[model samples]
Target: MYSPTPSDWREANRKRWDERVPLHLASDYYDLEAFRSGKDPLRDFELAEVGDVTGRSLLHLQCHIGLDTLSWCRHGASRVVGLDFSEPAVDAARDLAAELGLTADQASFVAADVYDAADAVPDTSYDIVYTGVGALCWLPDIQRWAETVAALVAPGGFLYLAEFHPLADILDDETGSRIEYDYFARDAWIEETPGGYADTTTPTVHNRKVEWQHPVGEVITALASAGLRVDFLHEHDTTLFERFGSLELRDGAYQFPVDRPRIPLMYSLKASRAVA
Candidate 1:
């Protein structure tokens, strides 16, 4: 199992993510050039589910490089703010926004630890709080993260998240062959062979990345505990990114196999605060 409980684990993860921001931007996965040409990287599922944001105040958490944040402004959001712990990423995002002629007020970027994002940005000021794929695993504790989300969202506002389900995290994918990890949260960390999904040549400095698993039930319960009511929870059998190592991309989305027991690959949840 992974070491470091919620406390120090989060700090370490934040630092690691900060270091990875630059690498990710240059990687093919992000495709910054395509994003700059006004191309939207968001999937149709999210685009449809999130609906319109015209004139709404939106806050994007862990908005690595602000691609989606800019997309929000392009879609008619009056104000959009992006928060990330990575300084390099935030700088690039700010520069990119300016390069695109987006006014400073229309979109802004902040670099801060995720847990402290609410303190760095406006409190109770956002109409929508948005988070996306591969976000939750980096977080060690969902409860504290929920509190930060609740703090930033205004009354009647909602928090929207589309993330890879925790269940997918457990399986083994050594040969892109079979399911491996436990379905339930058991170990704090699982020691894996060296290699990241993006880069397989270089050995990771900290080969082990600590993670926590939160079942759909635990996720809903945690969010509700933070004073946000669960509006809907939808689980899909497909994912946006390549997961389980050998998954193939088809029809603009990644898929496993239909023959195997359909495991929940992704989930989206909307929660709202009680009007005061």
Candidate 2:
């Protein structure tokens, strides 16, 4: 495993993500063939929560490979921009956008870190600012992230975030039957795994990476402090992936077995900046 200084974290993460772009594009989990055939990866809850993007401009932060970003375009977003730190991912998104017959005015991808998004993207603000699941854990500073997210939302617009619940991070990864990690710990959690989440058997070289655990209260408070009002915070018993071995796919979502007690495995929120 690689133990990197704070300054090295972004570079390390970028390398790992960049290397995985091709792997993820080819992975059966992503199923690019199906995607090209008009498969939408945006979860049902995301569609309901971010209702009616028609004629709206959207900016998707940490938008890996831009699947969800373009999906929004498919739903009638007037324009969409997808941003990511990995250049490879950005390139893949642009190619996919072209293949989908979307013009630059309809969909664009930018290669930039999330913290620099305010200056990196084409617009000063968007009708909607969206972040998808598994994005927050990669960020080290929740306050900075909240502030960035807030800045990207246009007046009268809102930010929609869906992520795996931090509570799930505390439990053992194998069975998730016991608490094996500290939810409040601020130190960076570094791990080196052999394969990407999209395909566990695939060989990957840049496996070492850093992650953080931001509690639910901390996230909500940070957003509020950033001048965004919390419209709602809804916790769910289902998650997008098999976060734990104990979870099983049910109705297109991963959850514990029917016989097992339920827990909040994921959460979604809407926070808006008051109309100026």
Candidate 3:
């Protein structure tokens, strides 16, 4: 298939995210002050699935604003480094780390594309390589992304990813019931919506952004192909965002109405590089 993403995706997507930095920082959605007061942006399942991080070095790929990265530090990760393509995002992350009284050795942020993570991070490898939610869609090639991330994983260490289920891409956005798009379609998805998800009413420029869907199977295959041992792939019925109009927010999670048949709205996976 002909690809238009290679020539233009980075600049467009980075511009979109960079512009949203201030919006996200000020918006009630992120609530920076509350975060400073000790808010956990991470999902409960994520905390349990990844297990203890005490004294372990962690590299958070595509860590926007460092809320989750800093959270790992609170969870006892000895060192945490966050990387993002947008300089604005990385700056915000660095500020957050400092505000939390964390030094560079404890928590650091780098401005770099996720594809260059192996070469750009502070260390050659980490005990844990983490990818947070809603980040995978921004990348065009799951395979290349897998290889890049896999190389950053230290021997006996693992990579944990929590992402929106790609199956949701095929469903209608309003109801999330009717099949509306092809799941296997290989093409760049361009969106020109003028606002960020954090504050939809807040108007913004640099609206053009590109995204792509990678099926759960494709992601697993990519990681395994990159020499990681797949430990577990867990699908969750709840999500943090109101992805569908019909979703109901209950106990910090959004779920389909009780009458509606439940489907996986998010998924998490653990893939580990074998200890030599």
Candidate 4:
């Protein structure tokens, strides 16, 4: 039986993310140089799903290092704010924004827990609330998360969530075909992962951490209960990372082998708040 206090788990994860900031900044996977040279950090799925943030005020929650948040500004968002629990990540984002010459009015970064975002951020509502890949699994409570998301959305605005499918998490990535873990949300997963997806070779001090899994149904239901109407849910066979051994890189994304069974690796949902 593995059970840890929420504060303990959050601290462990924050330390891990803090260590990852430097590695991710230098890793080819993130391509900091490309981002510095004016390349978009956002993926194609989000670009199509979120559909143009030009002059919109966007909020990115659980934003690690704020690559996607900065990208929103590059796409012409008038206001972009990123919130992450990791201090190092937030600092790096702020430095990068300054280096890129983004004014304070254009972008800002805050160090705060997702659950405490209402206190950390000034605006109670935003035109768009965007949360990207690998963000949800870190949150233990999806219902509370959805409530925060709903509170952040301006009237008539929408929340866009692009996350790795829970099904993908159950698959045995080492074997790449069978399910090894529980598909449904259960107890917290406590483990010692010294390496991260970005750079596995680099050793990390904050190795022990906790993660939670939320099924697709749970995610949708949480949002709906939070007063947001689900507009659309789209699942994709391709993913941003080669999460399984059987997956192959195709056009910058990972796809299952031609002969293998196709499964949903990622999903994006758009939920809207009605005007007051």
Candidate 5:
């Protein structure tokens, strides 16, 4: 695990994420009702392209609250396991699993830091290692993250990821029109003052959060170095969530301000081990 300069930064960020869990569950972004009724928030492209997962042992990394993980089980994954760093989220996931009666011999939840507990998870155990949206932005290093992914996969197994595009990160959050941040990797920790993304008025009373950006090339190269062959790299003009300030929801998709029509909003990649 690559240590941050100030160790307190990580703790503070973790706390902030823990506090945001309930809010996210309540937010429209993660509609619990829809999810409970067998609705899959993931786009059709991902569902269609990922193909049949029935009877597969699937591992979900950074599975906040395990909504998507449970969704995978609902979609016929034989065994589904969710791993996350947040204790509150993990607890909530367990409770939801029990309440929904989704618990089975094949479903379980595990909690640990993504970087530190790599060895804790069994090696060559999972047939499919899946990651969801809004996951990669929390890490500090893409190479280390890739190494973690490589360590988790079984021989001949596949790794799948759907994340916000690097180009989307370049837009100005306030105006949402001009490009502000760089496309390549940049290391600058952002500290939001108090309030959370869902409720900006109530101060979170914490201001330390860290995030890292990895470009499309950097991500592809890192995965390839980890011995995962790229099967598909897709850039979509739509997003699964509201990212920019000026974006509008149309026909179940989020789009730009009409001026920047060429930019990609999200990306999904499917990679498999050489043995696969």
Candidate 6:
């Protein structure tokens, strides 16, 4: 029975993300150099699913270091704001935006917990609320998150979410055959991850953190309950990273073995608020 205050878990995860900022900045996974040279941080699936963002207000939640957030700016978003709980991550995001010659009016980063995002961000509703990979696991309550997301989206606007499939989370990354974790969110998945996903060679000071799992049904239900209408849900056999040791890289994506049973590695959903 693992139970901790929400503040405690949040602080722990925030520390972990804060420490990973520097490593991600220098890591090839993020490729800050290429991003500076006008490379788009967004993936092909999200671009196709979310469609064009030209001249629209976009808010990126759990946006660490703001690569995707700034990329939205390049994709023709009129206004962009990135929000994260980690101060270091927020600071680094601001620095990168500045270094890339992006004015504050174009893109900005704010330090705030996602649960408290409604209060942290100035505008109540944005044209688009975009959240990218590896962001939702850190959250403890999906219902509350959905509420915040709902509130952030304006009437006729949409919330775009792209995350690792919950099925993938349950499977053992080492073997990829047996289920190692619970599919549903019963308790916190506490772990002592010394090295993060970005750079495994370097050890982190904030090693202990908590994570939660939300199945596809739970995710959609939460959004629906929050008053958002589901437009569509898409699953992919490919993932952004080589989560499993046996995965093969092709066309810039990591996928399971050809002979093995295929399963969804990631999912993307688009939900929109009804017109007033």
Can you give the TM-score per candidate against the true fold?
0.89, 0.97, 0.98, 0.97, 0.90, 0.96
Model 2 misplacement above 4 A:
1-5
Off by over 4 Å in 4: 1-7
How high is the CA lDDT of each candidate model? 0.79, 0.92, 0.92, 0.90, 0.79, 0.90
Cα lDDT for residue 106, model 3?
Answer: 98
> Which prediction has more favorable TM-score, 3 or 6?
3
- Show pairs that collide, candidate 3: none
Assess candidate 5 and give its TM-score to the true structure: 0.90
Query: Candidate 1, residues 1-276: lDDT per residue as tens digits?
Result: 755464566555656665666666777777888888778987777778888989899999999888888998999989999998778889989988998998878999998878898778754469999998877777767889998898888898899999987777767754334557666754467354344554556545655456777777877888899999999898888887677666667788878765555777899989998899
lDDT of 5 at 22: 78
lDDT by residue (154-234, candidate 4, tens digit) is 999999999998998887877468877778747788888887888999878888878998999999999999999999999
Per residue, candidate 5 scores C-alpha lDDT tens digits across 63-147 of 9898888888878898888888889998888887886786556677887887754665544468889999888888777888888
Tens digits of per-residue lDDT, candidate 3, 188-210, equal 88777799779899778899888
lDDT of 5: 0.79
lDDT score at residue 116, model 4, on the 0-100 scale: 91
Alpha-carbon runs more than 4 Å astray in model 5: 1-5, 122-124, 197-202, 257-260
